[model samples]
Target: MRIGIADTTFARYDMGAAAIDELKKNASDLKIIRRTVPGVKDLPVASKKLIEEEGCEIVMALGMPGPMEKDKMCAHEASTGLIRAQLMTNTHILEVFVHEDEEEDPKELKKLADNRAREHAQNLIKMMFHPRLMEKEAGKGMREGKEDVGPL
Candidate 1:
């Protein structure tokens, strides 16, 4: 399958590269296409192009919104646009975002973003080829610092 990486340029760190690396490591046989947007608000259009024009079955939209009021609003708008694009194209765009204010320390935030990116890469794989895995883990909380709630 063809996958698209629609990442933003406004991120202070290289979350996109991290996500792409995870995807490559997990799904080496899949075709990967990349398009960088100026900011999170630009992800929808880039994702649309990747899906509608480039024939990508799925898109991984990566960005890190800064610790500002406008940053949240911009992320919301981009998410709304992504929903619209998904409905129009009948494809999935997995929006991966890490808010700068979510952590007090820079190192913590970077680690969080990196972990989220890798988790979403696994999520992308589950979405495409293994819905059963998603269903089995639905509504399960993280009990011991682990992301999953164990197998069904």
Candidate 2:
């Protein structure tokens, strides 16, 4: 199966790399198509192209919004576009976003981006190859970058 990874240059961390590493480890046979763009808003078009043109079954949209109000707004708009792309293609585009304002330390933010990407990579793997596994974990507050907060 083909998988797509769409990332941005504006991000402080290389989230796509982390997702690629996780996918390679867990699902090495997949044909991963990676596309890099200028910023978060570009991911929707890039991801759509990966699915419609490149024939990718699913995509991972990785981005890190800067610590600014304008950055957050851009992230929201990007997210809306991603949803629209998913509806248009009838495919899954995992939106993995790590906002810079989430943590005060740059080091922590980088770690969050890496962890979030890796975790979503696992989610993509499960979606493509092991849907039953995902169902089993339903309602479990499983997080990627930090600890998993179990379901209440």
Task: Tell me, by TM-score, which candidate is best.
Answer: 2
CA RMSD per model (angstroms): 2.8, 0.8
Candidate 1 lDDT, 57-142, residue by residue in tens: 99999888888999999989988998998999989999888888878888888888888888888888888889899788677763
TM-score of 1: 0.90
**If scored against the real structure, what TM-score would every candidate get?**
0.90, 0.97
Q: Pick the candidate with the highest lDDT.
A: 2
20-119, model 2: which lDDT tens digit per residue?
9999999867999999999999999999999999999999999988888999999999999999999999999999999999889888888888889999
Candidate 1: Cα lDDT at 64? 88
The worst-scoring run of ten residues by lDDT in candidate 1 lies at 142-151
